[model samples]
Target: MTTDLVAAVDIGGTKVAGALVDGTGDLLHRVQGPTRARESAENVLRAVTDVVTQLTEHELWHRVVAVGIGSAGPVDARNGTVSPVNIPAWREFPLVEGVRKTTGALPINLVGDGAAIAAGEHWTGAARGRSNALCMVVSTGVGGGLIVDGRLRPGPTGNAGHIGHISVDFNGDLCPCGGRGCVERIASGTNIARYALAAGWRPAEPDGDVTAAGVAAAAAAGDPIALAAYDRSARALAAGIAATATLVEIETVVVGGGVSQAGEVLFGPLRRALGEFATLPFVRNLEVAPAQLGTDAGLVGAAAACWSDPDTFLIRGEAGN
Candidate 1:
């Protein structure tokens, strides 16, 4: 039995992960390295290069037909570049060129991490069988992607489905993205914890570990402020999701990330808020579901990008590259 595989790279603020993914959505070999995002841009690229080197050295490397890279946005797939928000060192980084130089210029599919997640979910998770859907990650930051007409629409720049920066509250607090009332400004895990702390939601433990998880613990213990913080985040997320559904006609929204793991504490309010915002006739049937894939969604989605549309695969030396 011949097993076809693809080399997958997932680049984030904290770490750079790589894997050999088989056609069945299985990761055969994996390696990772710290991103050291605060370091120089060359240092960040070194970490990514290390991941590619490890993957190519595997004996099964020959079975890998292509490479797929999912990086923090905003990514320009058309120009084969990326400028991740968290990694300040990488401003319009030539990611595709770096990967090509390391891997002998194999075909590469570059996409924003959000688009990768949507492709993964569409292939094997919550959005499976749904032609039009939205997939999101609400962790240290919020990000999302879209599926349209039975295909992942990464858009020209590969950052099309970025829902986090969308202004849900025009007159609200200023966001890091220079927008007021962005969904991420209120709904991200970091913001959730910040809101809880600013509102006097102290931790039960005396260590002062005021994390989103800590806030979740407080909410679980019936802390009113913590619960209200989550409610506020949920409301903002609902507005963003509803706006996406209203504009693009998505039928489902699959939410993943650390915040979503809070389960009902977040979803209960998010669903209720969505009911209030997604009131349009076309968007009335939009449904929300939990992402079935965990952290591995990025890896699976990277490979799925290649499998999802082989014809449009971006070769290393192609015009875009």
Candidate 2:
């Protein structure tokens, strides 16, 4: 199969981002659209169709063979239904089929946004050439993906990697999943600010506005409350990584997301906590590093998913796969 191009769409909580990527992982074109709450799935489909058709109609996307989509959590890839919490209208919605109908005849392979990041890391990011790695996105909510034994482990119904809900503390905090003390509840960028407020560390939030970025800025200015918030976040995040490493035997933990922009405030203490918590020595060397893909990871990883066979894409079939 001579190479051409593939269209990658990343359907996030607040937005739908799409890019036309080539075989070398270079994006040819990119565009985005808004994601409104309570907006019917049909409307979402219309918005996406408009952007994709606009791109494909331009002849720039002529060679595009397949479409790879990365959507929000609770997505059913086999059934091609999307039931994301942030977007209520998508409950059991047929996103892939809708787009397929609108985009002419093309094969659409779908996976969660977390899984797309994992595929991107394995294809060209931090976890490149490594097997059994944990790919985490610590943004508004903590999300995760895995490349175990060189295979994509998208749960029974393609919702396997909802790692944010993993309980880090039994009595920590109540998560949206009805679980108490989930990693996301305590460690996610959104939660970091919440936890800070509960501890009387008020930076700002007249309308619940203190974001992870705001917290980072305050901490940079040497605010004790912000420092405490980041510390707790690092502790919770590290504990989760340790447990996951033990369970999956992942060689590395590649961290991404906007909160990860806090840099050492999040990772430095994270490494220390991981070292303190990990019981096994082999798992200790699980180098925890920041993700390098930036905002383009989603699209590139979505495009990378089209190259399902690692051997064919990475040129090391015998090594693993």
Maximum-lDDT candidate? 1
* lDDT tens per residue, model 1, 1-321: 126788999988888999999988889999999999999999999999999999999999987778889899889997889888888888888999988999884678899999999999998999999999999999988898999998999888888789999999999999876789999999999999999888888887789669898888788878999999999999999999999998999999999988999999999999999989999899987789999989889999988887665453434225245
Give each model's clash number. Answer: 0, 0
Deviation from native of the Cα of residue 116 in model 2, angstroms: 0.2
Q: Can you write out model 2's per-residue Cα lDDT over 1-321, one digit (the tens) per residue?
A: 235677899887777888888888888889888866458777877777776776677567767767888887778887888887677777888888888876666677788888888888878899898888888888887878888988767665555656787898998667777789988888888888887777777555565447788888788778888888998888888888888888878888999999999998888778888888776977888888899898888888888876673323444233235
For candidate 1, give the lDDT.
Answer: 0.89
TM-score of each model, paired residue for residue: 0.95, 0.90
Off by over 4 Å in 2: 204-209, 309-321
Please give the distance, in angstroms, between residue 282's alpha carbon in candidate 2 and its true position after superposition: 2.9
Worst 10 residues of 1 by lDDT: 311-320
In model 2, what is the error at residue 16, expressed in angstroms? 0.6
For all predictions, the C-alpha RMSD in Å is 2.9, 4.3
RMSD of 1: 2.9
Query: Can you give the lDDT of residue 98 in candidate 2?
Result: 85
